[model samples]
Target: MARLVARRGRWFIILPPLLFLFVFFLIPFAFALKISFGEAALRIPPFTDLFGRGADGHLHWQASLANYRYLLTDDVYVVAVLYSLRTAFFATLMCLMVGYPMAYAMARATKSTQNILMMVIILPFWTSFLLRVYALESIIRDNGLLNAVLLQLGLIDHPLRMMHTTFAIYLGIVYSYLPFMVLPLYATLEKLDRTLLEAASDLGGRPWRAFFDVTLPLSMPGVIAGSMLVFIPAIGEYVIPALLGGPDNLMIGRVLWDEFFGNHDWPVASAVAIAFLVLLAGPIAIHQYYQVRQVEY
Candidate 1:
């Protein structure tokens, strides 16, 4: 009776989150999936229904795979998707490279110092994300603080073209997402067994060698977690790219927006979004697989 009661109690604790996921994520996904198979129509919802009563006085199912088919055939879709992927991959790489060292330093710091550094890392989150990106504009834009300072210092005769460039997009992604990478890495590094490193040192292993062989391998889970955290959202990022990037820097998010609002092609937009979600799931699945393996080991 106690065991059964405990089981029910556990489920009671879990039920709200399960219900939330079902209501929010799953339900919306179902709607999008249904719409992906729809055709754009001159109606209220602007898309054809999956089920309707026909003129023959019978209920009929209607669906079209034309949107998905068009996705494969469209050069714009392919180019946008490829660009988004490339941008996300490089941005994730940059975040990881910069964050790993910062996280390592934080982990190595004394407890009070660690607290200060952690606060510094987290302070940006207190401000609005969009506002932070806008703030970056003040530093990077022409006649902004950075260019002003550089001019004052005689570093360059002219204000460099910083805004509305691919470099700005990359900078935006890295700046915004760096904390996400650092936090996970710091968590993993903090909980690491220092005794193992000491053991390796006692065996006359070099610091760099120990880091490569022991620390890096042990920290793989955190690396993967932080990577996914940055990569997934960065790929689907609309606001930053739309604001910072030029016309040439077309991402999938922009493509989706133009398809939905610019072209008013609801079915194709739904298909693109669904396809994007499916693409994102691959990384998520890989992360879960590694997490399970880590737990098993």
Candidate 2:
């Protein structure tokens, strides 16, 4: 009777959220998938075509693979994909570099210190992301605070060209996503046993060896989780690049936006979005498999 009651209580708690997700998230995703497979041109009718032409001259309902072919063969799309991948990869790397050590330090700190550190890390999130990026622009632009400081200190004769460049984009991404990486890493690190390090030391392992064998192995899940959190959003980000990136710095997200809004080609935009999903699905599947294996082991 107690077990039955417990199960019923759990079901009550789970059902509401599940229903909400089914209504909002899953339904939208399904609709988007259907629309992507159809002729979803933004014409006068403003309707979707599944398999037949309407009054308009456009192919209303034709199923075609030309969109996918274009995505695969188009040099511009390929370059954009490569650019996005490279940017996300390096941004994730930079986040890991900046976040891991901070997480470690926070994990080892006193309770009060840890609380303060966590607040400091999270406080930036209270402000709007766009505002923060704009603030970054002010700091990095010519005649910005950085240039003013350098000039005041006689470090340089002229202000540096830091805005509207790859460096600015990288810096913006790393700054924005650093807290995501640090928080997860800190959670894992906080749970780690200090005695494990002592045990390794007692067994003749050097500090580096102890870290490699004990700390790093145990922290792989956190590292992977943090990397994914940082990388995935960075890959699809449109605003930061639009604000900070140069004309030559083309990302896939920008291309997709241009197709949909600028050129009014919903079919091509949907195809590009689906193509991104296809490219990212492999990595995501592998990551999920690894996550499941981690749970199993």
Best by TM-score: 1
- Name the regions of candidate 2 deviating beyond 4 angstroms: 1-15, 39-48, 53-61, 286-297
Clash-forming residue pairs, model 1: none
Task: Give the TM-scores of the predictions, in the order they appear.
Answer: 0.92, 0.87
Clashes of each: 0, 2
Single out the weakest 10-residue window by summed lDDT for candidate 2: 39-48
> CA RMSD for every model?
2.2, 3.5
Which prediction has the highest lDDT against the true structure?
1
| 85-114: candidate 2 lDDT, tens digit per residue | 999999999999999999989999999999
What TM-score should be assigned to candidate 2? 0.87
